[model samples]
Target: MRLIRWLVPVLIWLAGCLVVGRAADGAEVMLPEKFQRLLPLHEPLGKPGPFDWLAHHPEPGQTFGQYVASRPVVPDRRRRTIYVQPLGEFTEAQQRIVELAGRYLRIYFDLPAEVRPAMPLKLIPASARRRHPEWGMEQVLTGYVLEKILWPRLPRDAGAYLAFTPTDLWPGEGWNFVFGQASLRQRVGVWSIYRFGDPDRDDETFRLCLKRTIKTAAHETAHMFSMLHCIQFRCAMNGSNHLAESDRRPLWLCPHCLAKLCWATKADPEKRFRDLAAFCTEQGFDEEAEFFRKSLAAIQGRR
Candidate 1:
């Protein structure tokens, strides 16, 4: 099913109010000196357009201090690898995106990531499958996948286990479809590339599909570590209600969210930026590469 899209003009005004005044006040002071340098390079989220995620969700964004206080789930000596499990058959192009997403996740979180062998779609029994009421597309129940498929097969050393499927997903009834879904406490999530557009169409479309896949993968994985939707900046952790909103989000985290990830994974801020910069450059994502390089420069005091 095509994801829903619409615009709600007056709601844009409310997007301004999504950030808690206290969180904004404490944002900078909560992070280390290096992370604070990243503040000026990042922009606050633009006003949400009609039918935007922020306009409808209205989240009171989390701050670095808030995230730390939550005692979030973080990787330990025993379980630190992020595992990506393929749930069904994928086109050569689609498979390429999946593999790249695993590599991106490694740099994005500074975690060890592995792409496992594909699990046949037939593994998902008929009970968990349904044809969308109106859209007529075959959809899998996300809850079933998370609990039955992912949870059971979760590896002993996995910090987070994510199922990458080419199938459509619905969390349950009353919702049409979702781009992806994750379990905050379970450390298991499932996302689909089915709605991300066909990567085989062209070079530009392939890059677009790769970017979108990376965004959702990183965004949902952070949830398992207890990072909430970012309200303070235009960031990867920000809640995306649809493809348009997700596309508007950058591939990097805001300082506050970056601080959270760095702390959770014990990753060095400068090194993380440098790695992402190199990865983007290698992938032909010139704009994203420049942004990563600029962020690294900010932390290194070169800018």
Candidate 2:
């Protein structure tokens, strides 16, 4: 079954492609063509460098049609809230970013989002914690966080349960460290702000940290609904093997991926763009704000 791929332990960080091609299950999904209007406003994906995720892990990209055909997880009236669980202590600035992420998720998905009370790191056992042999940075086990800590506490009303931490994360042996990790079926995911940069730094660095956190948070949450990476355009869903590549990726979803998000979340693309543009403007993301404004205009048939 196609779900077998998702059931297997898979960890997706802020990550993909524009293949409006056949789905693995070969089921067809009728998509609205309105999203096609935004194509002129987007740029195609550039060639990948040797260290980029595409260069190493070439994937058959999923389109809006394929995504819907897959019968992805979607929010329902009973299970419509996104819960942000804090796993460790965070600085005041880091806490602010987490709160903002929750707000952004609420706006981005048109779902209610809540930031839960902080959970002590002491709750994690020694078995699930480790110190990197080479880097000497203490790290948390991503698998343990998902299965052990998050699974048991999964709230009945949660569409997605995401854990935020300040520690580095590692999936398992042989893997060095991960920016974050999420399960496709589990509804639980975790990411660290430790490497996102010190938000306590100056204003520029704070904005940078905020942008990275928001990107990762939104990207990982999307995976919970089975949205794949976009190879079709320069998009928020594109994968990155390293920080540089991720930094280069825009904070906007491509038209194809945007279609998937709107379908999955039952969101209005026009309203989503307006909300995003407003948020970006407030956050001093001038370029992204302008792009979203243009996207809004394009979709509305405004010249």
TM-score of 1: 0.88
C-alpha positional error of residue 148 in candidate 1 after TM-score superposition, expressed in Å: 0.8
Query: In candidate 2, what residue range of length 10 has the lowest lDDT sum?
Result: 11-20
Off by over 4 Å in 2: 1-31
Which digits, one per residue and each the tens of the lDDT, describe model 1 over residues 11-51? 55345434432343544335777888989988988788778
Error at 194, model 2, angstroms: 0.8
Estimate, for each residue in 34-96, the C-alpha lDDT of model 2 and write its tens digit. 777888888889788999989998988887777876878888889889999988989888899
The alpha-carbon RMSD values of the candidates against the true structure, listed in the order shown, are 12.5, 10.3
Q: Which residue pairs in candidate 1 collide?
A: 7-50, 8-50, 8-51
Off by over 4 Å in 1: 1-29
